[model samples]
Target: MARCVLQRLLLLVITMTLPMMTMAGEVSVAVASNFTAPMKVIAQAFERDTGHKAILSFGATGQFYAQIKNGAPFTVLLAADDETPARLEREGVAVLGTRFTYATGKVVLWSKKADLVDAKGEILKTGKFDKLALANPKLAPYGAAAIQVLEKMNLTKQLGPKLVEASNIGQTFQFVSSGNAALGFVALSQVFENGKLKEGSGWVVPSNLYSPIKQDAVLLTSGKANGAAQALLQYLRSDKAKAIIVSFGYDL
Candidate 1:
């Protein structure tokens, strides 16, 4: 009968999907603020392709490190710098040999105004801006890189008073976008897409100006038993994730 056939079809569909439903799992991920845009896209693709969910928390790498040390339940960490993951591994908080460099970050002197920043970044020397925003160097690697750029140019002392420090690269970008500061040093990934600035103007800081911002991903001890967490870490190294990272102006 038609009714019997319909019931059988529904049962078959549920039976086929049962394995996938059981395999699907969720993982808690702590991500660096600068990687917000790309990570969102990657997380979406990861879920679509693998049936695993990533619950992301974005913040400064230093703050995340502190939280992880205090027994936060984060299953994985996507750090803005390599040191944090290495330290965590040494401290036995992270799974040994599971850390890998995910991306090399770049810094940019950026402004929301289209013509405010020149290609060569001479604006910093011109001192034309009232306030120059950056992340707190003590907690954010991007902020430390910004300080390095200033020191390399010998403008640290001269520009000291103009500095406005934010808690993280995200907040630093907010400060500039909100016009609370004229300009700020932020991750190039935050403002770039598909080989162009998404908006406003920016000067890409040269690599020689500061230490390489080698972002790394690691599985925390808390994630060792989590299949989703392990799968997510492996996914980060896949070509699809690398392409997403590259589109956002990060180097793999």
Candidate 2:
């Protein structure tokens, strides 16, 4: 009887765990560079709750768009701007009605030095820095926003010569953090955590300076049959993911 009980317990355990093992899957996601930190946290939570894994690739949204157009195998896209996903949807590469704004981003003028950037961003007028880094405006929305900020302040012409362009917001942050550029316009999430700046000094660019950065997420055509991909998209809309996004200083 004890032997039969042991066999029954083993069978019950297998029955309970087999479905989770079979349902667990991996989704490949192309994510914007600015969303990296928060996405990592959310992905972890998603895996824990749903038994699915997220495989993430981070880069400039424009580059990801090009890759998707070329038939990249990405299952989903988390873009820095709403335009790219809408374009994909129009082109029939992404599923219609699957795109939505996940986060609204803010840009900041930041420096590794503790006191280089003033609260009101007077440093842009001061012109004390030799190299000011920003992502390539042609490739990154954050870069375009930075340009708008400079133009609104009427300092673009004066600062143009000192500008150093990076391929993405992540690289832009590296340029400033490495001291190659004294200061740069970067996503606020890069330098903020848990309601405070992680390091250095920064000026939160006023919203009036540029268009809103409405970051969006979408399910790609390649993901339509992917259970993990669908789960991840739904997970992104959950309160858990939104809290993580907010913790990283992004607006919902």
Candidate 3:
């Protein structure tokens, strides 16, 4: 019994230390799903130059806000919109004067095969397929854009019922990728991250179709002018990172 108790305590100590060890010289990032591809590229570059690691989590802006409110220990947040980051600062949870728009996102209707979408954007109304996927508009900005485009076309009432909802933009893209849904409304970046539409055919939603997706980033209260956080932010604005961003189909 005594030996077993000792071993158990030793295991507990090891488990607790593991996280601390991984976190040493590392920054915690709560990145919105829309920006994952470029963020990953920038994080890799930052790690190479500074000898520090970035632990990143990608999700909807609303979810990350909730987690930060609950003290999730994220040092930085790259949000799909500016409002949430501003709200966090107002709530005294994020660092004031450290928030700014990072990138502008584009939306697209994508499918695994070509010619799936028509010029009229009436694919949803036609109801010619098993499913049409989009992120939950309440949780994701791109989802909201999809709704806006539908409403502007006066097709919301007609096409609303045919929508299949995903929890985030990434999952919405996956629904189309896995053939769980016929096609999806997703950030153009996710579909373009792998270097153009090699397999899938996509409709690049016109700039006039919906509101511009001006994504923003902020330093959290958990971050200061620390070497890691500052470096990461600076690295994000570098020319190298910007090149990667454009390569992923996002407008600068």
- lDDT scores for all predictions? 0.97, 0.97, 0.85
Over the stretch 31-61, how does candidate 3's per-residue lDDT look in tens digits? 9998888888888887877667899999999
- Would you estimate the TM-scores of all the predictions? 0.96, 0.97, 0.86
Sequence-dependent TM-score of model 1? 0.96
TM-score of 3: 0.86
- Report the C-alpha lDDT of model 2 over 35-127, residue by residue, as the tens digit: 999999999999999999999999999999999999999999999999999999999999999999999999999999999999999999999
Per-residue lDDT of candidate 1, residues 1-252 (tens digit): 999999999999999999998999999999999999999999999999999999999999999999999999999999999999999999999999999999999999999999999999999999998999999999999999999999999999999999999999999999999999999999999999999999999999999999999999999999999999999999998999999999999998
Task: Tell me the lDDT of model 3 at 146.
Answer: 90
lDDT of 1: 0.97
Could you arrange the candidates by lDDT from highest to lowest?
Answer: 1, 2, 3
Task: List residue ranges in candidate 2 displaced over 4 A.
Answer: 1-7
Candidate 2 weakest lDDT stretch, 10 residues: 121-130
Off by over 4 Å in 1: 1-13
What lDDT does candidate 2 reach at residue 199?
95
RMSD of each: 1.5, 1.2, 9.0
